[model samples]
Target: MKVKLMTALCFLLINSGMLNAQVKDQKMGELIDQQFKFADQQYKVLAKNLPADVMPKTYNATTDKVVTSNTAWWCSGFFPGSLFYIYEYTQDAEILAEAKRRLTILEKEKNNKGTHDLGFMMYCSFGNAYRLLHDPAYKDIIEASAASLSTRYHPAAKVIQSWNSSDRWVGPVIIDNMMNLELLSWVSDHDGDKKYKEIAVNHANSTIKNHYRPDYSAYHVLDYNMETGEVLKKVNWQGYADESAWSRGQAWGLYGFTMMYRFTKDKQYLDQAIHIANFMLNDPNMPADMIPYWDYDAPEIPNTYRDASAGAIMASALLELAQYSNKAESKKYLDASEKAIRTLASDTYRSKLGENGGFLLKHGVGFLGQNSEVDVPLTYGDYYFLEALHRYKEWYL
Candidate 1:
């Protein structure tokens, strides 16, 4: 009789778990559907207001105007990238049409070597274009853009120069540059050129060596001397202070290293990504909702702005990292990502339909130290939020 009781209890527990799984799946499906529907509407309004010659950058709620940037802007690809993501979910012809239109203007950047954002400027735009359309034309553009990005790599420094020499620093390599390595990795896979992959690997290695604190949190910028391959300075140009942890910088590192693991299957990269993920998640200053402040160590923590962009990027990266983690670690990463996604989808972060200048998410901090684009809807924030949703749907759902 006791054996039968044990068997019955086991059966009940299994059924309960299965039922909970079904409920969770149902909720996630509904969330993705609802968000995508609203995203489609928001982007349509954005499309109407966007000028034909430039890309959407941010919206000034106070000014009630959509800001624009030229093709060379680091964030130029995000608008088109967001459109492609919406199209992927909604299959909206209008979104696809708008994306193609922007692609025409952005294709000119394939020859632009002056910036290290070609991956963001070209890959996020053309990469999705090719992934969705499988067009030879987009492939050609990606190849050219990869070549252009290659020109920025300094062999001695073993890293890509993020920005040209400024009066303050020369050969500055920012953590954001890590996000651009995807373009190089993609090119190597298709073009049969190992050189692009080598550059990406070298860059990742150099970043691992110089850009990180001992705790695995990354710095915003590391200026190196190109000739001597020496790191001249570790600075926080965009964060609260020189040693403070910039929230978006950490997100970029997490996403970039996770992506590097995807391309190279390097266990070291995966380990680094996991460490960064843990450092960000375990930090005492991280908000309960998983939406971090603009800087992790920002002085006015409770008073500071929450960076939705950082949250979105971290959510997307964590979801991918979950795939490569052990069972316990995977659950931890997935749970954090789910919490972040739910928070960002809430009214506080997700913009209302026809509001927020057609952007999906809100309260992104871009260069808060410089007093620019603070607490506004950023194109990249929307892009990564959509990406996190897509990853959840694709990988978890």
Candidate 2:
């Protein structure tokens, strides 16, 4: 009788463990499936609505109309990342082919010297494209972009310069440039170039010193004297004036510093990332979804729209932070991130089969001032949302 009772208890324990593992696996599978479904649906809609003959470099969606502008650099990365996600999930050759073609088109315009958004436009999209596809031509394109980006590095200021033509921003370094340093690090690794790594580290350190406000919220741009390496000013180009924190800028700092910590394992970068993330998570104005509007200081109240892309970016970074830090405090941030992702996957932000360009989440503001694609579908929003979902599955579920 005693032997039989012990055997039954062991059996129950084994069965419970198996059941728990199975449940977790099922949850992850469901999340990945949802992300793939969202991506697949968006791809179909974009392919159908956006004509092939339409110039890829000139498309911009605004509230009034979809205008053709010569400088649509940032959107370039968003579409490729979206398509890449679809290809990753399905392994469909057609998806890969289309992404490759789009990347090829982007390759041509990489050296245009028009904007300061090279990382968003080129590296994140084209560099990631090359990394996944393993195509030599794409690699060449990224290498060239890395070179161009390296030229923007102001050695005296120990940071990358923004706005090439005029002194209007002659010594200015923006938080957005933090997103660009990944390319430098990648180039340093790929081509055995020490200068690339040095430049990237210098730029990251400079931003760490100059850009962050006392509250951990950061300025959009900082003017540094190129000759003296002195910070002349910290200005807000995108946020409300008087040094308000732009929600997206904060996200950029969180994401960028997290990346820097990943590469260097520097505690300062990790600390900075955690500081900004804490501010964002604790802010009263942030919605339940953990996504904020373009500016935290925007006058609009409950009606203020949220930036889904910000949440997406921060979610990805938070997952990285969770892995990087093994403390109770880190767990708090991770829990908050999981909650945010759960909110994003819930009905509030999620889209139906035939709404808002079939994107997974809605109410993403692309350009607030222009009212362009305000509270509408954004490609990066979709990409990062799917990415966070993928990471969630890989880690917890």
Candidate 3:
């Protein structure tokens, strides 16, 4: 009798496991199909309205206007990435052909001396497109951009300088620079250049040591003494001026450290990523969906606006981090990310099919300076949302 009972228990466990696996596979297929349909429709509309000559330029959705101002260098990456996603999902030759044409234009713009965003603008979009397509022209363009970016490394300060001009940000290394390290690491592996890897590692080490607070939240910008290689000031350039933590900066740290771990397999980087993620997840003031306001501790919480773009970007990063962690608590983080994506897919933050000038996301902040795109649709928000959805389908179904 005991032997028969044990046999029944084992059979039940095996049957349950099989059922779970089948459910996961089915959910993954559903998510992928939804994304493919959405991308197909979006690409057709964009291609029909947006001129081919302006293939990679930034545009404003509120007024259905093209941005003729100084180009938003890093922000333009979303356009190419969006198109590439459509190509990946649909295998439409026309979409891939258009992506190649736009990337060629971006390659020419890299020759300009004032561009400070080679990684965000080119590598994330065109370089990633190349990685997927295995095209030689994209490889050549990425290599050249890597060389140009490496020139900004200051041997004295042991950090990469933030901006090209001698303006307010002169000699300062902003937190956003952390996101650029992946491009260098990618270039190092692709071209067999050790210097690029060295620079990336050195910059990451310096940032981990100095930029992060005990809570795992980070400053918006850190001004370094260029000569002594010492920390000068840690200021909040984007959020409340008095040392507040910007939500997107935390997302960047979470995403950046995760990428570093991916490249180096360093436990410390993964630990830092986990720590920062915990801070964001456990903060009492964070919204129910795990999305946060521009500042976590901002005053007037009721009126404070949410940055959906940050939530989307962090969800993608958290999914990657979940694959790397062994602790049970890691599953909690992954679950939270899944919930966040579900919230985004709901009606609250995402634009309807034909609303808001055919935009994907509803509330995104751009260039705190101009306050131009506050609470409007943004290209990066859409790209990151799609990316999170894609990752969700891959990991959790």
Candidate 4:
């Protein structure tokens, strides 16, 4: 299976900057055609199948079930966000209407202070809406969401809280929190308050100090002694163990720091992004096709299930990373990203027509340690895959 997947993604290794080369090559042309065709078809099916108000997380093939959540769930935005991505790609009228409907429903969550995924939920949905349409209402929604997210920041901890003081953790700050900085940074630059950007940079610097090990691998969660402003413990909530590198967590860190460098032109953040990318691409366990196991430390090793979502996120981040680096460094990052994109575009990771719960990508592992949404199609898998496609086209095509 892995061998075939690698062969399929080989074209992704072709320099997409050579658009003329792709135009001349019939095989590469066919791959691009198939990819977008699959994207459009998946969205059309997803638009009809998904419930209007609920957001999909994953599908259980055995139970023939679509596991879903309300607006309060951390993953709630990806469903609408994926729609906006498809709408942008296809320009289909029905997709646009469906995306708008879901975006409106998602806009209500802007003020929810209970969760740290406001960036994933509000920023991904409304950010795209505002970006594409320049809607003033969407801008307001994002600002409110940023304000709500800002409330999660603890002055002493200097980091955004991932979850409230739960029974298992006290003021947990997860690697996933890195992703929320983009929303904060965006709000600050768009004629909004500077406090947001300041908070974001503080959080990034703090995470760099406390959340990373010597090898640059990140911990999934950090428990803080907020009153004392100390890191209480490094632990794992979603990973295999405290020291294990969770695949999605690594991707979040990579993407977040790369984005930070883009916004602030901070060489430290860019260096961090490059360091993390080097660790990932050089890891002995990374598959030949560039898709990663759910947890880098999983005992299962070669047999462990793959997380296409992580690959998608990593690819998108590396595309941005390529743009920020010098020529020699940029080629290495871009090549790595292109390899992952090809693997994701392959049938091994992508869903077959009318299969896989109407999602574009498959084989994503979400919280396998908790036995939740393990080895299933994830909404985020599709969302970031679309984002990777757009980034590739924007920079290389």
Candidate 5:
């Protein structure tokens, strides 16, 4: 483990500008270190007993419970991905080993075509592994995952179906599907397969046409007619109502399009991302702390559950969006990202020692309307929180 750790550090020194010592905000920099310190301890304990063949989903504080899933689950990659981010920042050898172990457990899902989340499940974990380790095997896993994901793409609908026809979703292509295109884009570049990029662009263009309203707010799901290329319904599968903005869904749209802009350099994709950002950042319902409620239109308003996961995802996306925007526009996103990170790092969101079922961030909502996973610490929450931290240090500092 020590030898591998040293070799990885040596590679980090030569491969990228990801390592650093410069400190822009002394307070935040110190806070970042403290955050990782807590995380290092928490994960060491949290992951010490992980199932031999699966991934942790979220920690349930109410029941003192820890739920886990097989690699086929959509969220199965986040635990390892978050660990990789922490390992990148702290160079913790044990963390890296745990992440690698989880990655191997998750590797079999490369051919899972039953869902559209291969990108979330495979790319998030293996993608980070490939980026940091530069391992050729990781690329092979990613390419196979991309192939599995592309099978779900419907040519007539011009979108990747997020789910098979289920009692709830019914062959819908949700806003969340935007997050999966990164894998497709990467395969296009690495394998010289234009088909992968073509599928991603088609999905993006179709999503813009059908999923978004005039105000740039998005519905959580859009039921599509694959045979006729028709939109059947636009509704929120996870939020309060058909008209409400599920906070994390909005974040997915924000991050997805911004990422699409990065891959394709399409002005329309950039404009779409900017429009979504403007709507979300300026919403009257946005909380003072910069963390958003589970649903923007929840009847309870201030009393509704807050989704720290959404806030974390948005902050990470905003930091990157700031880099692409003009100076005047950039400040809003950068400031928003900074404030959100500060709030998450606070005792308000950050867990106490060994508390919150071994999760780092607190108060994330999975699906309140379904009476499940409400106000718990989620794996994706921690994943995006670490990602936001990584962005903060690299971009701001």
Candidate 6:
């Protein structure tokens, strides 16, 4: 009798846990549906307002001015990337058409090698288009863009040059450059050019050595001596202090390493990503809502501005990272992501339809140290928010 009672209790517990999971998934599914619908509607307004040849950047509500950027800007790809994500979810024809129109305007960047943002400016926009449509024309454009990006690789430094010579740094590589490596990785895979992949791995390894601190939090920029393969300095250009943790930079590192691991099955990259994720999520300064402030170590603490862009990027990376972790770790990462998704979907971060300059989320700080785009709805914030929502819908719910 005792044995039978114990067996019955175990069965009851297991069934209760299963039931709870089902309920949670059902609630999350509804939330994803609602957010997608809202994004689809909001982006239509954005598409209508965008100037013929430029991309949406941010909006100033006080001035009712919608700021835009040329194709060469680092953020040019995000607006189209967000459109692609929304169209994938909603199957909206208008969104799809707008994305294509923007692609035409952005296509010329494939040959522009002067900037390090080819991966962002090309891959995020045309790459998604190719993935969705499987168009050979898009493939040609991607190839050209990858070639352009490869010109920026410095063999001696084992890292891609992020910016041309400037007074700030001779050969500066920013943490954000990691996000661009996906373009190179994809080109290597598709074109069977070993050099692109080689450059990517070398860059990743060099960044792991030079960009991270003892605690695994990444520095924003590493000024390198291109000729001799020496790191000249480690500094934070956008964070509050030279050593402070910039929230978006941390998100970029986490997302970038996770992506590298996906393409390479590299345990080293995966381990680095896990360390970075933990550093960000477990930091004492991380808010209860999981949306980090603009700088983790900012002086204001509770008074600092929250970066929805950082929160979105982190949430998206965590969701992907959860897929590759052990069962226990996966659950932890997923729960953290779900919490962030819920918070971002709330009114506090998510913009109402037709509001926030038709952007999806609000309160993004582009460069708080420079007081640029402070407290605005950033294009990348909307891009990653939609990406997290799409990831949840596709992989989890």
In every candidate, how many clashes are there? Answer: 0, 0, 0, 0, 0, 0
In candidate 1, what are the lDDT values of residues 76-106, reduced to their tens digit? Answer: 9998999999999999999999999999899
lDDT of predicted model 2? 0.70
Question: Which segments of candidate 4 are over 4 A away from where they belong?
Answer: 1-30
Better candidate number, 2 or 3, judged by TM-score: 3
lDDT tens digits, residues 40-124, model 3?
A: 6665655555565554333465367644322345666667777787777688888777777667656665554355577777777
Native-to-model Cα distance after best TM-score fit, residue 253 in candidate 5, in Å: 0.3
Every candidate's CA RMSD: 10.2, 11.6, 11.1, 4.8, 9.4, 10.2
Residue 243, model 4, lDDT: 89
Expressed as tens digits, the lDDT of each residue in 1-397 for candidate 2 is 3453355335433443343333333455675677586667656656555545332322233342222223245566766767777787778787777777666667765675555567777876777677677877877777777777787777888988876536577577778889888877887888747788888899899888888879999999888788889887778877766478788788889989998887788899889888988898888887654667668888864445567678878887788778777688678777777766765665455666655544566656665666555565566677777777767767766
Name the 10 consecutive residues with the lowest summed lDDT in model 3: 16-25
TM-score of 1: 0.93
Q: Output the worst ten-in-a-row residue range by lDDT, candidate 1.
A: 15-24
lDDT of 3 at 381: 74
Clashes of 6: 0
Deviation (Å) of 340 in candidate 3: 1.6
- TM-score of structure candidate 5: 0.92
RMSD, model 4, all Cα superposed?
4.8
Q: Which stretches in model 5 have alpha-carbon errors above 4 Å? A: 1-26, 167-170
| Candidate 3: residue pairs that collide | none
Point to the candidate with the largest lDDT: 1
TM-score, per-candidate, Cα-based: 0.93, 0.85, 0.87, 0.92, 0.92, 0.93
Q: How well does model 3 score by local distance difference test? A: 0.72
Q: lDDT of model 1 at residue 97? A: 97
**Prediction 1 global C-alpha lDDT:** 0.90
- Which stretches of candidate 2 lie above 4 Å from their native place? 1-28, 53-72, 165-168, 370-372
Q: How far is 138's C-alpha from truth in model 4 (Å)?
A: 0.5
Looking at model 1, residue 147 earns an lDDT score of 91
State the C-alpha lDDT per candidate.
Answer: 0.90, 0.70, 0.72, 0.84, 0.86, 0.87
